[model samples]
Every structure is written in structure tokens, then in C-alpha cells.
Target: MIAGREVAGFSDREIADLLAPLRPAAPDSTENATRRDAFADAVWSCLVEPGDATAGVLRLALGPAAALVALDESDAVVERRLTDAGVPDPSRLGLAAARARWAPRAVEGRLRGAFRSARVMGVRLVVAGDPEWPGGLSDLGAHGPAALWVRGDPGVLVSGPSVALVGCRAASAYGEQVAAELADGLVSRGFAVHSGGAYGIDGMAHRAALAAEGTTAAVMAGGVDRLYPAGHHDLLSRVAARGAVVSELPCGTSPSRWRFLQRNRILAALTAATVVVEAGHRSGALNTAGHAAALGRPLGVVPGPVTSPASAGCHRLLRDGGAVCVTSADDVRQLVMPTLDLGGDAGPLRLPPEQLRVLDALSSRRPRDEAAIAASSGLSAERVAGVLAVLELDGRAVEGEGGWLRGRG
Candidate 1:
């Protein structure tokens, strides 16, 4: 059989069966993928497939890249190794490094259900080279996902107006309060709230997003099939039922040391903006913050009591000029969507670096072409458009015969 044989001839389920035992033990990581044994034969079947392409999908579907990531290899290094081993560059890491890695894991019915949940939650997939792949992830560089397995209304990833809320696992009252409130407000105002499904701040954010009846996504550390921090399984399931719970791994693969670090890159890459509610100096939340700032995505740090250790990291980020200080959900709202401010209820004035440029470009000039806007604002076209779209929708700017100009209304 050539690489063109229909996969229908070979059940993916069967390949998945063979791959199950290939799982290299994690660093005592999430073990959800190890719970069953029915998916091993499928792995062998996939490896021995008649065609190269079908055989390739078998590996992509199994996510061996994730196992390599767990071994501390960068996506670039991993891609090279795969290619050297004759593994085709599938997606996410077609060339550049992708963040998510799929260590060997089990294939489970629950994960199959996650595929169904994309439809159930109204989310859609953004394959590696898909036109709709959000450019924001370019910030992740070699640490982005090989492909984003998404859930939520389709196109939400690339379209606009999404922000992430992340923080400490041992959240304080203030941290939880801030997270829930901000999540609710952002959702109510039509922004998608993305977060890890950990306890403390992440959980509060997801719950608040749901309560506000807004779209939310959970970027998991493990495969979407297995919920990490198992206590939140119900919460995660509810989210999968309504929104998307994404992962970079194969359905049954668990998250390991390298996987979690890479997963943080996914959380950072997926959103145009990232807000850190509370974290300690060594906090993993800080990892997400690092990716956000490095990628030049809007980075925010919510203020907390000066005395709290949780707030220590946020304060450090602000002091280092690493992030803007955010007091309320409104601040996050502005940093991610500056042009679309609603004055009355609009709480604070923390603008992303891009918004400040648009304001500067609006001097007594009649209007400006996008190129001039980029030159004047010192922001990239993609960055400015992301900001401008929010501004236009918020009635802050108008597209006239002349061009994009500041609007009085």
C-alpha cells in the first residue's frame, strides 16, 4: 500500500492499542494514560501501516514528541531527531519548535469523547499549518504546540478578544476573589477566558467564566482525556461539556516535567494576553508570565496585599518592568482590549504597549494607513490589528475612506 491508502482500512483505534505499552515511564507524572491496556496492538498496526502518510499520522496521533519533550529536548531538537528518525514534520512543529509534547500515554474512551466535546463545547481544531492558527503563538517560537486540540466556538483562537488568567495553587482569599471577579467580568463582556485547570486562581477563573455564561477554555498539563489534579475532574468535565479543554498530547498521554513546562508555553501562546493573579517568586505561574512577556503578548500582574507571598511574584514582575500592574478585571480588559474601553464601568487605565502607540499615532493627522500606524505606533501590523479590532468594536476608532483614525464617538 502506498502512503495514500485510506486510514479507514486501518482503524486508528487499533494503532492506538499497540502504542499503549510503548509508554516510557514519566517522572512520576500524571498516570491517566496507563490505566488501560486495550490500545497496544493499534500502535504496532500503525507503525507497520502500508503507507508513509498513514504511518506518520499514527505517530502524530500517538504523540512520541511529547515523550521527547519530557526528556528536556527543545521542540527544535525534537523535530530534528524525529526527522532524522524519518518521522515526518506533522504540524505545530513543522519546522519551528512547538510547545506541547505528547509523552507515551494510554488511549482511552474519555479522550475519544474529548474529540466529540469540541463539537459539544463549540470549539474547533487549529492544525499546525491551518490558516487560522493564531499568530500570537509565534511568540512561543520553538516552544509551541505541535497542534492545538481546541474546544469552544470555532475560530475563537484566531478571531480576537481572548485573555488568560493564571496564578498560585495556594491562592488566598484576595487571589480567588480577584480571579473569579475578573473571569466573570471578562466573560460577560464577550472575551474568552483561558487558564490551566489547577487549583487556586486557575480554578476560580474557570468557574467564574462559566458563571458569567461566557466562553472559557482549559489548557491542561495532561492529555485532554485525563484531568490533572484529579480533584477537578468534575469541573474539567463540565468545562469540556461546554467549552474546550485543550492539550498538546495524545489523548491518553500524561504530563511530565518537560511536558508541564511546555504546556505553560501553550497557555501563554494561545492567548493574546496573560494575567498573573498571584504567585511566588518560583511559581509556575511565573513560567507562563515569562512566555507571555517573551512572546510580547500583553502581560499583566494583579496586585495583592504587599504582605502576601502570593503577591510577591506579581510585585516583582511589575518592579522589573516585566508586566503592567492590574487592580481589577477591568485592567486586564484594557491591556488586552484597550481601544474597546467602556468608560463608565471601565475601571482602570493599564494599556498594552500597542495601545499606547495607536494613541500616539492619532495626533492631529486626518488618518493613517496601517503601515504608517505601525511605523508611528512602533507596533507590528498583526499586533496593532489585534488591538485595533478591539478598539473598533469598542467604538474607539473608525475605518473611514481615509483610513484607520481615532474616533470621537
Candidate 2:
């Protein structure tokens, strides 16, 4: 039982129905254990708000089932359990504060309702261990989502390389045109496009990608079933038919101001890079850029006319050296996959075999000494040093205080 509700018969039936679409053909003897964990994760999705680090820590220290059980136990027992699970200082995790925050939303009836709604809507529950879960999300650590409620093909979330194109909802004509061109060119180059599924730049991006016959995913601020911004209901439906429409919240939850900001983090984490097509000084697209930079993902911005207020935020990013200036799909591609060629009329940006190996060995987050890079790329220190100099000049790599690191390009 979970949250004082029995997990047998009715509850089990609903969970099984919701997860049926994602289950593998090969049956396992531990089916009951899998069901229990899935149920616990589903309940966790409803109990905590998006990006709750304390809850993330709890879920990490104890498995979802054990974590849920700890909620009803005494504080002393909970602390002891956390200690046993290798937490150095359980009190530092703010267990009291988390418990207070979660108490009001711990209704078992609501939990069951979310499951039924998902089942009826054909939404599948995807947890951390699932094959369909995107690997990039692990970077968010404890602040990552507990689970994802997906309304379309879960596999699309992990498909190939993807870039997020975002901007203000009230985009200008110039901004929309730029977004559409970028999306079309990116999809033609074999990249999937991701966006917020909003009206302006986001809508243009999704539509262009679809028109080009490429996969595109929309990360929603509300529940997949709610499909906020009702005007884009048909657009989101088309995206779901071809790709995926996903959220961290359970079914029936409405989009709130805070939730929209939290949703930006998922968009940043899900893609290899984030490109702000156009944004005002306070546009929410800038919020997504911040999250991408924080995650060590490459951030690109399209520069608009200096006189245009719609692009003030983008110009700020460029002037501050926080993001690379990307005017075309080729530029955005280099930001995410620096090793790939630009192809087409621009010709391929080819590198020597040795240089390519060393470039591949470079880390974007950690700086590596020449010797370490040499060892990884199977090259001598002398050859590595020479290649590093060329890469640095090309803006494909940088020499940091620690050693060498991948550049944003």
C-alpha cells in the first residue's frame, strides 16, 4: 500500500494499464517489484513540485518505495534510514521543510486519479531506470524530475541529436522567419527540433520541423492532458502524432507561472544545445538559456537588429560572452557537435585524423592536461600539443587554467 491506500486489485490494474505501452515483451519474474517501483514513482510525481532538490535527495538515498514509506515514519526513523543509506548528514537535507511542503498534497485519492487519467489519455509513465529516459537528465542530479508523463512516442525523446529553439511568445515577424529557417535547415541536416509548443517562435520551429518531415518534441509546462495555450491544441496534437509531448507533472495539472519556469530546465536538459531565436529583455526563452549554460550545454543566440527591443535579451547574452553567436543552422551545429562537417556549399570542415581524435577526446565540462588527452586519444604528448594549438585557433577548443577544454565555437 502507498499513502495509506491499498496497492492491490484496482490500483494495480490502473498502473499496469498505464505502463503497458512501455513494457518490454520479455516478462520478468520481478514484475511485482517493477510495478511497485513504478507506482511509487508515479505517486512521487504528484507529491512533489518540479525540481524539488530535497525530494530528489530523499529519492536518491532510498529507492522510491522505501522513500515513500519513510514519509509516514517518525523523524528519528527517517533520519536513521537516511544515515544507513550513506547520507553524511541527513539533517542538512531539510527533511522537516520538505515534509511540511509535501504534506498538503499527499492525498491518496488524487494519486489514484492521476493514474486513471493517464490511463484514459494513453499517457505512459517513464521513470529513471526506463530505457526511454533521456541520459542528459541525470546531469540535473537531485533537482531532476522524479518521472515523466508522456503522451506520444517515448522513444522520440532519445532519438538522435536535438536542439531547442525558443523565444518570446509575442515574437516579431523577423524573429518568426529566423526560427522557421533554422528549424527547416536543422531538420534537413538530420537533427530533431525541440520547443515549448507556444504561439510565436516555438510554434514556428515545431511547424517547420514537421513540414520538413523531421521529428520534433514539445516539452509542456502543464500536464500532457491539459495542453495549455489552448490555441495551439491542434499544433501540439500534430507534434504528438509525429514525435512526443511530455511533462513532469501528472495528468490534469494546470500550467502556472512558476511551473513554466521550471519547465524550461527540462527543455534545456533534454537537448544537446539551446538556441534563443529571439527574446525581449525579460522573455522566458532567456530562462532556458540560463539553464543550458548552468548544465554545461552549449548556448547559442541569434543576433537581431540592435534597435529592436525584441532582441535586447539576445544581444545581452552575446555581449556578456555567455553564448555563441549563431546566425545559421551551420553555426548552431558547431555549437553542439563541433566535430561534424558543415557540408553543402560551405564544404566540409575537415580535420587531420590525429586532430580529430584529440578533439573527440576533449571534455566540455572538465579540463584535461595534454598527457591525459594523449592517453585517451592514443596520441603522443608532442602530437597532442600541436593539435591543441590548431584546435584553439579554430575556436573548437580552449586552454583553461586547469588544462584544455572543448569550446562553444
Candidate 3:
């Protein structure tokens, strides 16, 4: 075993006392959480950041307890075990590098301090074996959390189907309104609302869920004890009281940019589907939508005015067929609920009314000259010429010896 892992690992008595909050409050309630599982998972959670698939693979190959013991092994031993476990590493150097990252955080004191802080802050830990762990998160494969540091009822994570409402931080009023209404509607019908508790659309969604007396889970980038955006402290506290404020990080860990990006995956994974209310061409919410798509979770986007830059990302998703256009809660429901029609095409293609009138002037069966078609369609000759050219390019109009007519089906 490596130098300190044997001495640095938490003892059973220490772990049992530190993780008592994770156990069921009811005397007769059945839950399998134990000191060994909670402590090892907590050690791993602090050892790696969110979405560390390497840690996940290790924990799975040798259960969390054995994995903790193995972390103290030589780099060669860990590497060989990883290789035998079928983790891809053409160079066989990934485990060695991961050792460098994990070594500094493998101390038992730091692990104990995290649990102690959580106890003082009323935070609870939940591991994968717990019944309260959201099953939807298993879809993350090797990127699933090592353990969850949560405030509020963990049961909320497992209860009912959930929808993620995420978008830009500087969302427009229209975006916020749409997000709130969507949350309200989904919650009224028994869906829990989920989002990162950011300012604009995310805050709107959470507040709406609360207003509707529905549960909402906020997956934080920082530790649950250290709520990042001070502005939303009260809101998040309410969520923790009524629902959940959860993270993979231990107490005292602050938020970072990379952590924020990685955090999007949990928001995507914990829900049945994701809806991006409004986002810029480069919004982080697009990252969440991408994760959802990668997980095969249904992704929906609300359309914005053609002029709004805030909605550009959503429009891009629709145009690229990365998301289905969803305008209402009903549209979102169709994504997760069964016995619903495959939704219709997205927002209408913006076309000039005069162009439609001009196109209408030409029949698929008959053809007419520009002047005649212009007179029939109540358009000037110049307008008719431009419209016909555009229509022809779009395969909506065809020109022949007779003149112009609608294209064939």
C-alpha cells in the first residue's frame, strides 16, 4: 500500500459517527447506508471532481470500500487493475496521472473535516446504494457522482418524473415568464422541477415550483454548504427545506468555472428531459442540453423572437435538429409521457406575406407570364420576378415555356 492511505483512511468508529445523518431517521425504515460506504464514497468525492469517470470506474470495479483500499496501492497496481477492469488507456498512464491528483486529497483529516462541517451545517450524505439516490443519475454511466452532499429531503431526488428548466443568466422577461409558466404547469401535473439555481431562468423555474408547492432540486457547482450566488441564498435555502440542494463536492468547496461546466451534466442526468428556455449562442445551458442529448434524454427549446440574440442558441438547436421546439408544458409532457403524438414541426418558417401571395398566384397545373401572374397575385412586376426566383430556388416554383407555375410534389 502507498505511504499514508493505510494510516490516512478513516476508522469505522469515526466514519460511523461522522455519517450518522445519512442513516434513516425512522427506526424501522430500511436503508443500506453504512459507515464504510459513506466514508469511502465521501473520500472519493473529495478526491475527484464531478463527473470523474475514472473514480466511478474504480469504485465499480472494486466496490467503494475496496476502491478506497486500492487507492493506497502502488500506481502500477492501480493501473493494472484499471486495465483489467477494461478502462481504456492506450498509454497506461492515466491512472498514474490520476494518482497525482488523488494523492493530495486522500488525507483522512480532510475527509473527516468535510463530514464534520456537513454535520454542523445540517447537510447529509447519500451514496449510490441508498434508495433515495435518483435512479435517473445511473444513466450517466461512469460519470455518475461518487456520492452526493445534499440539503433537504433526498427522497425528492427519487420521487416523480422531473424536468430541467435551464437557460441564460441574463434571461429576458419573456424567457423568465415562459420558464415559470412551464414549471408551474409541469409541477401541477406531478412533475418536479429541476435546475441549477442561477439568477435568471433557473431562479424563475425554482421560484415557480415553490409557488406551485412543488419540489425543485438545485444541482450546485459548489458544495451544498457554500451556496455560490449569494443573491439566491434565500431561494436555495427554501429549496433545501422543501426539496433538495445537492452537489458532489464536500463542504467548504467553492465554485469554479470548470466546475460550473461539469455541473451541467448532473442537471441533465437527474431529469427525464431538459428544456432550454432562452440562451445565447454560447450559453452554458447549451452545455446542459448537449449532455441531455448525449444521454438520449429528450431535449426541448422554446422559440424566441427572430430578433433576440438571447434565443439564438435555442434557434440553433432547432435548426440543427438537436432539439424539438416546445412552446408549452404540454409539448414538454409529450416528451416524457407515453401515448402522445410525435410532436409537429417547429415554429413556422418566416416568409413574407407577399411572397406567399405571389406563390399562390401560380398553380402546379397551370403557368402564367410574370405580368399576368403579378396582376393575378396583386404584386408589381419587380416583386413578382424576385419572388419567383426565390421560390424556384426553394423548389416551390418552376418556370417553363408557358411561364411560371408551382413545383411538382
- Tens digit per residue, CA lDDT, model 2, 1-409: 3443334223655666555654433255447567767777777889889999888888888877668765677778888888999988888877778889988778767876787788788887788888789988988988999899998888899888899999999999999999999999999887899999998999999999999999999999999999878999999999989999999999989999899999999999998889999999999999999898777677889999999999999999887654778899988888666766565434234456566567756767778899888876667899999999989988889998999998866
For candidate 3, what's the RMSD?
Answer: 12.6
TM-score between candidate 3 and the true structure: 0.79
Which candidate do you rate higher for lDDT, 1 or 2? Answer: 2
Best by lDDT: 2
**What's the TM-score of each model vs. the native?**
0.59, 0.83, 0.79
TM-score leaderboard ranking: 2, 3, 1
Inter-residue clash pairs, candidate 2: none
Q: What is the lDDT of residue 215 in candidate 3?
A: 88
Weakest ten-residue segment in model 2 by summed lDDT? 1-10
Global lDDT of each model? Answer: 0.62, 0.84, 0.80
Query: Which candidate model has the greater lDDT, 1 or 3?
Result: 3
Taking the tens digit of each residue's C-alpha lDDT, what string does model 1 give over 1-409?
Answer: 1012112122444333332332222223423233111122222221221112332333444443233231344556655656665556634433222222222222344434444443343434444444556666554433444455554333556554688999999999999998998898888666889899999999999899888877777887765667877999888887777777876554445667666776787788788689999998888999988877656567888888898888999999877653667787677776665554465555334455466556435423367677777765557888877877876776667777778876644
